[model samples]
Target: MLKRLLLLLCLTGHVFAKEPPDVECLVVHLKYVHCSWNKQGTPEVNYTFYGWFVIIRDSADVSECPSYLSENNINTGCNQPCGSRFNSFYTRLVHENQSSKEKEHELKTKVKLNPPTNLTVHYGSDSNLWLSWTQISSNCVESEVRYRINNRNWAVVSIGKQNYCLNLPSHSSLYELQVRSRIGYACGLSEFWSDWTEPVVWGSNNSTDPNKMNSSMSVWTPVLSVVGAFILIVLVMMLLHNERWVICDSQTSHTCCSFLKDWFKFPEGLKEGLNYNERPCPVREYCHVRQSDSESSDCSTCSVTTDQTDCSVFIPVNESDLPTPCSSSISQF
Candidate 1:
């Protein structure tokens, strides 16, 4: 009887001395099972995880984890192919000569999905800001969006669709947005929500109204163009005037006056009762020729001159030479 009593005490002591590590299991993306454990009171000792998934209402043979996740060359987690959703997970931790007690976990509510990716923001013509992202499982997940204006407090809203729109957004304020997702009820219930995605930003903090700036630009563009054309025309006119001044400075004063008068004077030849000569009245002509090949031993010859003609003569005119007009009455006195 004393031996039996000692055996009973030994068994009770062994059971009380053993402490199992805390284990956790999760279904990732509804495709695989991941189980991990932490050393509860055995920090110095490393633990290796092993798990088996069995249907809740069915019996199945045991299978080992396909891949083991390790830390510091010690097995710390187990990865197994996911079975039915209505299943229970059995996990154990082992360390060489010692092993932990088996633990059970229900996996129906333990699903966790990856975070949404490629978050995008767009401002539409209807004064609305649209936010959207690419989801891993498009129809099987729901999302929640949180946004803040100009680094202020965040506003969160739940959405079933992949996109959300904010109507009549403020143009002067900046908008910062993020989204997170979880499994929907139609697919399966998940107790965990995905981590929030990287933030997307739109709009600005400037206080100036964009519409007013655009209107001002439209108004000033045409005015600036007209002003530029007028300046160009004035510059061309000034250049032409300077060129005329240069031409006048290179000639005699009489020629310069004639040059200026020609621009404004009408043709005298087109007048009615003028008896002026068609050709110049007192033109002088002089002609001379010399032998180009004359030598020093040969006698030099004088050039022949033409005699002066009547057309070449100059006559002075006085007031007495002018013709007198007929009198209305032949000296009535």
Candidate 2:
């Protein structure tokens, strides 16, 4: 009898020694369960995966999983019509001896969900939130909510306590909202949880409220516009002020140019006060001719002023229209 018991122990040890298939399982939004084994690296017919099936046990369901590995060897599973979220489900694979080798996997540990999408926040009259978002993964799962006020530390709210996170405290102060998810108590392992979603803010408080910004920016907008216009004007003036001055060529200066200049020059009036006439060069064209003996002239020069009685004129000639030549013919005085 002792030998028989020893033989049973040996058989049990051998069964345990045989390596299990590498089984991984996930659900498609509760549409179906998919379990794959030893996807590609193994040398078995199905990439070292022998015909096998997944086994799952959790708080919600406890049984050898009905899901089958696909013939393609990559994927297989049973229909899970409930489309449920799973939490803390233990999973492993079973295959024929000498077919494949693998270890156990938790649904939560195996499947990593993307962050929730399209998070939005709206405050209701009762201070409740009209918050909503679509889960990133098609598979159904449970989620938790977190919130903060004015850049403070984050605070958590139980998803079970609040339906779809609707029981937030109503406040006028700004509030930041965020969410993270994990496999639920459904058919999957719930050991893993996704990273937090991007945050959303909502509020009507004027002071320190992100949504209610100060009006100082609006006031400064016109001032900035004026300054910009002034700068533009100054730039345009500077560009136009750079004038190219061409020297008036000296070669072109002539009588005509001088005449134009003189014509345009302001006239200073002629010399005033006591006027005395004097010819600049009085002796224009003449040589002194001696008076003829019979003429009895006092001087050789022809006289112009007739009223110099003391030195009476021998012959008067208009100085304005003077004679061309003195006549040499003799005449009696």
Candidate 3:
């Protein structure tokens, strides 16, 4: 009678639960069951939560779901035992706000998470076989593996944990295997299983490849070598360019760097014209002919060969033959 009254109180309090908790429940890839709830608009000082999960299987109240809790006894989620063969689950979230009665909300639909990936069946040894997979999240704790012999109905394989190997197959045979994992939340265990990983077939003769370890290294070796060679070439070119910038471009007239600076210098033709001719000019111009200091306006010309670049030229002139001073004019052609 007390149990019946408690059940009635629990149900009657659902409307007063005040903003029913958003609830969700799912079976993950036939691995495990998960459920969670959120109490909306409830204050912490007034917030005390109580949750009850009714795990329904095959139209029967099979068991109560396990509550996942936090370090502070706060509700995280819930997990329920489920194996390869699974169908559905129902979840109810409860809240208490200063009252003996509780607020409850039940999810109308089932929720599921993504399954494990890269299911591979490898030959562990002549006598054993290995099954491997990747977890979807760190919350994932373990996998529920289901397998079959030939065309037989599936049965759960007992492996201790999901992330690591537990036990090898008792003996090698033609087998089909599939696996799925469940999450362990900071608050509690996930009450749902992710979808199953893709099935893998382990042939009796299949063996783990000995050279698989070397494959990754072999691929990286050539790539690294090429990258190293490219870097070396770039460094050499950079050094050469820096040397060009310092040597010819330096303002200091250091003798040591002069030859190299000029050798590496860009051709003068790139900026301005260059005169390569070394031959002397065939003509000359002379002006202001005068004899001695006493003869103020006398001059005579003498024929002489001189270097074309010469700045000063000397000529011997007779005083009497010199020409009288006159207004200036350009030298005659």
Candidate 4:
């Protein structure tokens, strides 16, 4: 029974030692082929790789891996140039007294390209946006552009060229753009896509937006115009009313009419009249009469005078003392 257990253990060890590494090969940007493998359960064992192209009649022309990717001096991967011909590639991993099964690959479809470069954006005089970039791969590829407005959801567009135009773009919106590329159907088929480029930003709220300014002004312009017109109308009416009361007289120092003076009368606490008492003195008439203290007769001598000089006089007399025949003399004065 002990001998049987020893034999079984030896067989198990042999099987474990014969396990092969997992290998994979792919092409990059149509320039070279990269082959990599994962080490199987043997941490102490070292691996070496061999690869070659298959020709007509299944003839084998093998060669060692030109450049090796290693870890701890153990080969894990290799890189080689891909010539201008399409063929089946054969690869295998080998370690002393143990070799992995040969693996075959058709690399026409396993392609991946690098991201695009130098993305730029510009605003034209016609209020349009232009986005462009530089392509690093020489192969014919179709580009996809992804963009967002004002940090919103992303929108994608596919084009055959490297440049795109947006007509009549909004002045108040922000734009962000990125690009990715893949092999075109016209050149060949590829299952992989390149990585997206770095994001390019244009426009922002910090900068002045002409469209936003104009929109705000449009709401208040009409209200300001109406207020200005109302003020102008009030001023014109006041000027017309004041023009009717204005008068010029050569005889007096004041130029206002009598009706205007009444309109400008002061209140009870201020001065009373409009300077009527300050007028120049006019022509005067004088009347003279004499009477004795004795109670003898009711008649008296009366005299009247009209002056062209600066003498003036006034006298009061009772009507009963005036003789009826002398009334004509009093009437003349």
Worst 10 residues of 1 by lDDT: 324-333
Best by lDDT: 1
Better of 1 and 3 by lDDT: 1
TM-score of each: 0.55, 0.32, 0.28, 0.55
* Candidates arranged by TM-score, highest first: 4, 1, 2, 3
Worst 10 residues of 4 by lDDT: 324-333
lDDT of 1: 0.69
Clashing pairs for predicted structure model 1, backbone only:
none
Which segments of candidate 1 are over 4 A away from where they belong? 1-9, 12-16, 39-43, 56-58, 97-99, 207-333
- Candidate 2 lDDT over 1-333, as tens digits, reads 999999999889977664544555664433444555545444244322222223344223434445444555543433333233333333444444343333443343355566678777776776577667777443457788888776678788756322354556546566788887766666355565678888887874454554445576677889999888667655643553465222222334344344433543312331111122222222222224443432554334543322221222244565654444433322221
Give the distance in Å from residue 311's predicted Cα in candidate 4 to where it truly belongs.
51
lDDT of 2: 0.51
Backbone clash numbers for all candidates listed: 0, 11, 15, 0
Predicted candidate 1 versus true structure: per-residue lDDT over 1-333, tens digit per residue: 999999999989877764656888888877898887644432345666667766644565666566887766656677888887666778877777577787889988888888888789998888799988988778889999999986779999999889999988887788899999988887776899988988998887663466766888999999999888667656654774777653433225446546444643423532221122233233333222233433332222332223332444444445454422222211110
What's the candidate order when arranged by decreasing lDDT?
Answer: 1, 4, 3, 2
Clashes of 2: 11
| TM-score (C-alpha) between model 2 and the true structure | 0.32
Using TM-score as the yardstick, the better of models 2 and 4 is 4
